[model samples]
Target: MSRRLFSCFGKASSNPNHDDKATTTADLTTEEQRRCGPVVVELFSSQGCATSSEAELLFSRLGRGDFKLDVPLILLAYHVDYWDYMGWKDPFGSSQWTVRQKAYVEALNLDTMFTPQIVVQGRAQCMGNETEEILSCVASAPRVPAPTFQATFQKPTPESLQVSFTGALRTKVDQEGVSVMVALYECGLVTNCPNGVNKDKVLANDYVVRRLEKICSVKDISAKKTLSGTVNFPLWESFNPAKCGIAVFVENSSRQIFGSQNFQLPDNI
Candidate 1:
């Protein structure tokens, strides 16, 4: 029995042309299905904001094999550009994401906007700076039937890598206003504080939202939708393996998060 899921739209304001429906890729043999997995956790943050630093710290602490299951918490740090005028332009900031945040504000019916907002499961939002709240949210979170998402990371030479993911819809969903988003993040970013809030304190950040790319939308899921895309990373700077991983998730017909996951590829093929 096939159920219909209404399509949802993204909160971003630029209104980038999106498919909003299912897409197709080369046929995947049965073997391809074995390695896919869990939902994702997204954090909307900014580099120049002090509050966001706290949240980044929390994510760093949690990603340290502290959770019950070895299940790594998949995270995508969406660098927002609204706070750039405050001084210190975030190398990773994107104005388009700021537009998306506005849409979320309207959707959540909030009084105002702020930094360090954590979007969990695409249905809920919490302040990233609150450790207790984040812990509670993750502990009691609902379990979703694992979806099929395959990602491949390749380093053709050195100092550069390419990551790709293909997400398949598990249940039939009404493709009315939803969009499929493929987000990219960097791990193990350390900075010698100079001008920001934590001056002189060398801060470490993991699960950082370095970049965001909206691949398509739920409107494309009309019995023929598949989520797939790729993002490239440059390794010119120093990074840590323990603190690095790739994350991806899907938003529903109303721009609410529906699913997500994080992955750190194994070293030996």
Candidate 2:
């Protein structure tokens, strides 16, 4: 089995159950990017897993320096709960995330599931927290050739905010089964690890996945074309209003990332 999602860019298979599905995102105007902020790094992690703990620590330390550069990289940590059965339950784990991870495993044929996985630009994946490996991955990572996409949060009503994106598809990059996914997240989360494998450790999680809207394709991602769209964020009853934010990424059938960005829900949003 190939550990790849789509051999082509944004051209997912029509078969929904065939492990590859094509997607079309809603349309938007071209002016949205200027209002949206920086590039985001989404980390799939877990506290019950010791490996993720180290990755989280190392990433946190890196944020202090690597992010000081002009390109400004944002780090978001999502805690996967599948490992909760191993003597300690990760209070932050969501069944939805477990399902998401399983889908990636099935699509990519990972053979086994593991924590501390990092998806960069929805184009590649690597074991997280490994300084040497991560450095190499970044140094050799391909440039995101697609048109730039940007998003911002707008307060629509008291209970919901609108997430809008702007960009163009200069050309179809993925010949395989790559698609884009938009998500909402919460930032600056701290948990007390009283009983998990990370017991006695205080963990700070960033970019925690909150709501996933849909899989998308660049509207007109051709060389000089441009497009945009919006996703409404309904208030979830269980979510912490204070910690909620948003994350967006372009991913392939294998769950590798192509491009991604995230933002915090405005104080008023």
Candidate 3:
């Protein structure tokens, strides 16, 4: 929305801080949740990167709709493990996310992957801190058709959280080529860097991905078709449903996201 954007980090970086996780202000109206989400913003970040904090801060604004953009976004931050060797390890970093970022690198023909980068709707890519470019991507990105979802939660054991969801796809896509991705992301997180480029800094992260799973392979029937599946999220010592939410999206083998929606767990089910 402004030409005031900055250049991207080309395999090089700097440092900054982060944003608060989901807040009471992030809650949307029923109609907004019911409609097909406008975009899916995937942030590939790390606590080890100096510039990642700026990106995280920007994501927090987008997540909170601070700019009041018309686009509805489902945000997920994947803290990658590549930077751990620098000094400090991101408590949330994982090789799985590194692999995911690598796949995006290949799909988008990027020379290399870096922290504070974002993929919009699995179709557009940009530096995470490039606020203006991000907004541009959101305004022009292709979106998925509207979807419907009903979710239920069950605590079978203290260590496990079972989440079952039933939903209907409003559009058709190849069943074998795509799958539904369910991510359990948490907010209200704060970490103090012990070392690394971000040493001695306080970082606040929002929408940090805690668990990701392929709930089911997608199939589009000619008629109104319903799909249901369950994802058992391993409960951590500090797991709290209030600050966590489930984001479901359809992605093909090519890493193109078709549509996505986020749901807050109901108090009863």
Measured by lDDT, the strongest candidate is 3
TM-score of 2: 0.68
Summarize candidate 2's per-residue lDDT along 58-111 as a digit string, tens digits: 677656664343334546566777667656787668877766766765765454
Task: Please give the range of 10 consecutive residues that has the lowest summed lDDT in model 3.
Answer: 14-23
Better of 2 and 3 by TM-score: 3
Candidate 3 on 1-269: residue-level lDDT in tens? 12122112554221111112112113546464445455788999999888999999999989888888776889999998877777888999998998898888777766667777888777678888888888877765664565676778899998988988788766576544568888999998999887888888899999999999988985546325888899898888998888888898878775777677788976653
lDDT of 1 by residue, 1-269 (tens): 01111001112211112122311211333344333334355577776777677777777677665655423357667777766655567666787777776666666665456677765555456677776666655543433434467888787657766777786756455635455565555677777756555545566676666545665655535333566776666654654445456656666654655455656665742
Q: lDDT at 163 for candidate 2?
A: 78
Best-matching candidate per TM-score: 3
Which window of 10 residues has the lowest lDDT sum in candidate 1? 1-10
User: Candidate 2: how many backbone clashes?
Assistant: 33
Tell me each candidate's TM-score: 0.69, 0.68, 0.85
lDDT of each: 0.58, 0.58, 0.77
Mark the regions of model 3 whose C-alpha exceeds 4 Å error after superposition: 1-8, 11-35
